[model samples]
Target: MTGGIQAQIERVRAELTSRPEGLQRHVGRVLTEALDLARAWDVDPDRVELATWGHDLFRAASPAELVTMARAAGVAVEAPDLAEPVLLHGPVAAAVLEARFAVSDDEVLAAVRDHTLGLSEMPMLAKVILLADKVEARKRQRAPVMKQIRRLARRDLDLALLCWADWKWVEERTHGWQSHAQHWHARAEWVRQHHGEVALPPRVPETADN
Candidate 1:
């Protein structure tokens, strides 16, 4: 890592350590996962490291706070997002990182913005951070399917992404949570274009323990 990126990581770690344990653990896990995948994926380790550290900076903020931050950042807020403000954390965190920490790289900021709810044509670094966030060691403990995704990521990033999206879709359907329709459509399209009818692994049983 560059000296500058190392400094940024330290700054983020110092700030996050003072937050609640859940937030601290989440950020730590994402950072570790991102760094590990960076080498395999041939991405900039520094950028991935920075994005992971900053991605969840405002994850614990209240809905009203998220709205205020998003508006201040000039990010477009939708009605659904206003109703469920947690979804806005990615953009809000991206804005906050740039404003507060002097992280000006567009790719890094975009990765942070798209980490939670992925974009249709996300950058490779963005995909790495997003997938790392899902299959991080801590998260895999609770969601056994994440282990499979982690293994798949080592071989084929695109297929791993499709599986992650599929797993998320099934999870939302089972729990009756609102899902991001466009994100799924994009993942499906990307898989079809790249993989050409390759079969995805069977879904892990929801009731199974890791």
Candidate 2:
């Protein structure tokens, strides 16, 4: 990491240290995942690390606080985003990082914005951060399907994203949450277009009786 990036990391670390212990542990896990994936994927470690640190900076904000922050940051507060501010935390976090720390790199800011709800054609750095955030070690209470996605992340990043999007779609449908349906659909479509089909391991073909 460059001196500049190291300085940013220190600043973020200090800020996180003041937060609740649970939040700090979550950020630590995300950072670890980001660094490991960055090295494996040949992405810019500095960018991924910085984005991970700031991705959840405002995750605990109340709905009212989310609206205020979005307005302050000039991010349009649509009806859906306002109604379900949990989905807006990513964008709100990005805005806060940019405004407070002068983070100007669009990619880093984009990663922070898109980490929770991925974009149609996400950058590789953003993909890394997104997957890292989902599969971080501290997140141990995931369902079986989520465990599979986390395992897939160790082998193929694209496949991991596809699995995650697929799982998220099922979750939304089960919970009747439509706020992020478009995002999940767009990400799934993008993965299909770019990486072709993805699936679970196929069963071995039965040998013909001899």
Candidate 3:
């Protein structure tokens, strides 16, 4: 890693200290998982660490605050983002990391920006950060299936992400919650890619064996 990148990492890590203690602990846990996955996937640990720390910088902010920050950061607040301003946290943090911290790595910025609602096309480092954020110790405790996803990520990051999206789909349906268009679109692409098909018909009645 270049000295400039190392300094950027340090600055972001220090910024994390001002966040809530719970959020800080969560970031630490994510760092542990991210670094481990980075080594396994041959991603740069420093970059992963930077993304992990910066991903949730505004997580504790209220929805109104997040909307304000997103607007100030020049992030487009779409209808979904207006409905659920918390979703703007990642984009806001990414903007701050770039404009404030001078972190110029596009991949790192994408990882932090898209960690909440993953994009269809992500670099390996983004995958590591996203998976690590989802499978951290507390998250695993909350959802036992995260343990399985974490294991699957070691072998197949793409498959693990597909599975996670599937689980989230079911979860949202069960709770009668609307799916964000961005995530729904990304999940659709992941499904098509996983099946190695294009523009496949919807599985109206899903079964164990399709």
Instruction: Pick the TM-score winner.
Output: 3
Task: Candidate 2: give the clashing pairs.
Answer: none
lDDT of each: 0.84, 0.80, 0.92
Best by lDDT: 3
Residue 172's lDDT in candidate 3: 97
Regions more than 4 Å wrong, model 2: 1-3, 179-182, 194-210
Question: Each model's TM-score, in the order given?
Answer: 0.85, 0.85, 0.91
lDDT of 1 by residue, 122-146 (tens): 8889989999999988889999999
lDDT-based ranking: 3, 1, 2
Error of model 1, residue 17, in angstroms: 2.6
Q: Which ten-residue region of model 2 has the weakest summed lDDT? A: 194-203
- Give the clashing residue pairs of candidate 3, or none: none
* lDDT of each residue in 7-39, candidate 2, tens digit only: 876777677777778887898888888888888
Error of 1 at 166 (Å): 0.6
For model 1, where is the 10-residue window of minimal lDDT? 194-203
Better of 1 and 3 by TM-score: 3
Output the better candidate (1/3) by lDDT.
3
lDDT of 3: 0.92
Better of 2 and 3 by TM-score: 3
